[model samples]
Target: MVDVTYNSDLHFEHTLWTSELTFWGGELKSLENRLNELISHWTDKEVLTKLEHYLDEFNLQSNIVRDIQKSIQQHEINILDHTPNGSESMDIPRVKEHLKLRHKMEAQREIYGNLKKDFFLFSSENL
Candidate 1:
């Protein structure tokens, strides 16, 4: 009973995380488009260089989002596999894996948030 409750809670958390990642993916796309629009209005060498940097960072973050989403999906599958009957004991390793995923998601959010702030500042000044 306790194990089933634990698994249910963890599964729900993963579903939420998946939705958040999808939203981040969309935000990155929108930001990329804004960056592309800025490219036409700027011709300074340094500005172009900074734009390139932001684009690269956005690409990297997009990749990270996809990778984390995949990991979450796989982890969910592992959880389901371990609890096929819903009466089995909780998988400690899966719990640990979830914690690791949570950490990665936190770090990704912080890094991406800083990048967005920097990019917005740059765009505002350069636009």
Candidate 2:
């Protein structure tokens, strides 16, 4: 017999949190540049329209990330805010906001997939 368990002692540091924020900012910029390149290089109006839609969705994701970062910084919220030893009471605003962004990102990932497929089709059509 084997026993498997989960540990609730896992915690992240402030540096990790800040690093994540920085990563997201860079990621958004990269995505924006990619979309702009696609729009400028592709002559297909339909494909350009699709890319625009994806860019709009990407902007929404960027806004959500920025909002979360701002909220955390403004409130001085740390990664352990929702941890067992971190907060004495049921303070879970950070956790809730993170979960919300995660859900949005999950949906955004689907849009990204569609964008990739469209770009592939555009490439093949041009060739």
Candidate 3:
């Protein structure tokens, strides 16, 4: 019973993370397009440099989001495999792996949020 509950909770968490990351992936695409548009208007060396930096950061974040999404999907498969036959035996290593993924997701959210905030500030000041 406890194992079933834990599995359910983990599935729910993964679903939420997957949804949020998908939304963020689309946002990054939009931001990249906007940045490209801004790049055409800015000939100033310093502003151009800053725009390039943001573009790189956005690309990096997008990659991270994709990687994490893959990890989550793989982890879900692992959960299903381990729980086959409705066995009550919980895989300790898998549980630890889920915890690690949860931490990674939380850290990515904070880092990505900061990047967006900084990018917006730069855009506001330079545009």
Candidate 4:
């Protein structure tokens, strides 16, 4: 009974944390878009400096989110591993499903990778 309650509490906490992380990600993405737009329109040096500062802060926040996500994912995997009935095979089905979805996302991954690489290469040349 205590174990069940503990597991239930852990699950709820994990869910809440996951949702918060997702919300933060969305907010950060939206903020990035808005900042980009602002940077595009204004040529004032002071404003540009401020925008750069904001971007740095956003990047820091993003890094923190990524770290938290890694921790959360590790915890979730641990919980999955310790399920009742010694159901070790349960994770196999999830892995298979993830693999299937990953295959479907291969194109997206390629496009993103190319764009990211191109952006860095192009930006470096400009600098």
Candidate 5:
């Protein structure tokens, strides 16, 4: 079904462990089948609520991934813009914009990295 719980605090290690357990020892296919069955039986009101919740969670996750991806893409663009691939070198204005965007992207990546590292380490220890 939909993972509608709003938590950016999802532990990676916990997820990995749960996934492994599910496939190995837990109800893997049965869970999917059960969900399908529920969907099949769901009323219009219930289905709409489920969809709404899932959509909200999906959008939240989407925004996060999009922002990170955009930052990385911008970093690459900045690097390319700064480098002289053609005959002419980058001028002062272009160089300034490139450096600014590159720095912002680097900072954002660092934040994402640190959060992931902390989440993994914490979950590993707790698990």
Candidate 6:
């Protein structure tokens, strides 16, 4: 019974932290759009490779980011100790377009923003 009580409390904390990571209208979607533009415009076969890298990175990132989101959902967020962007940077070239998203931490006043706390980047060395 005691364990269950603790677990419930823990879950609430996790939910709160994840809520903050939620994407705002322009932040994450814009980045996705930019990546799509690169995908659409690039004629070279190498574009596939770049796209793969983007996908792979996104795949890996989502797991960790999801955990963070889960924590927020559980109300475990430490807003004061929280790190912005969650990491150093994203390497994807097209990412430059959405750099502005970093500025707005919250999507709405009452709700936490879900703008993907980290940037999604692709390496230039491949191309």
- How much is the lDDT of residue 107 in candidate 5? 70
User: What do the candidate models score in CA lDDT, each in turn?
Assistant: 0.86, 0.59, 0.91, 0.59, 0.44, 0.41
Task: Give the TM-score of each candidate.
Answer: 0.90, 0.52, 0.92, 0.58, 0.36, 0.37
Best by TM-score: 3
**What is the per-residue lDDT of model 5 for residues 1-127, given as tens digits with 9 covering 90 to 100?**
7333111122232244334333422332343344455556657775546534444443443355455445445644554555555523445554455446446545744654564455346435532
lDDT of 6 by residue, 12-81 (tens): 4335534545543234445556667677767777776666456454444445456545434332233322
Q: Over the full model, what C-alpha lDDT does candidate 6 score relative to the true structure? A: 0.41
- Candidate of highest lDDT: 3
Query: In candidate 1, which residue pairs get closer than 3 Å at backbone N, Cα or C atoms, i.e. clash?
Result: none
Please give, for residues 10-106, the per-residue lDDT of candidate 3 as tens digits: 8889999999999999999999999899899989999999999999999999999999999999999998888858664457888899999999999
Clashing pairs in 2: none
Candidate 3 Cα errors over 4 Å, as ranges: 1-5
| Clash-forming residue pairs, model 3 | none
Of 3 and 5, the candidate ranking higher by TM-score:
3
State the weakest 10-residue window (summed lDDT) of model 2: 4-13
**Model 1 stretches with alpha carbons more than 4 Å out:** 1-5
lDDT of 4 at 24: 67
Q: Model 6: how large is the Cα RMSD against the reference? A: 16.1
Q: How does model 4 fare in lDDT? A: 0.59
User: Cα RMSDs of all predictions?
Assistant: 2.3, 6.2, 2.1, 11.2, 16.1, 16.1
How many clashes show up per model? 0, 0, 0, 0, 0, 31
Off by over 4 Å in 6: 1-20, 23-26, 75-127
Per-residue C-alpha lDDT of model 2 across residues 68-118, encoded as one tens digit per residue: 556545434444444466443334565455555545545645665675576
Q: Per-residue alpha-carbon lDDT of model 4 for 1-127, expressed as tens digits?
A: 3212344555566576667667767777876787688779878787677676666666666676676667667756765765666443334444444344334335433543464455346335532
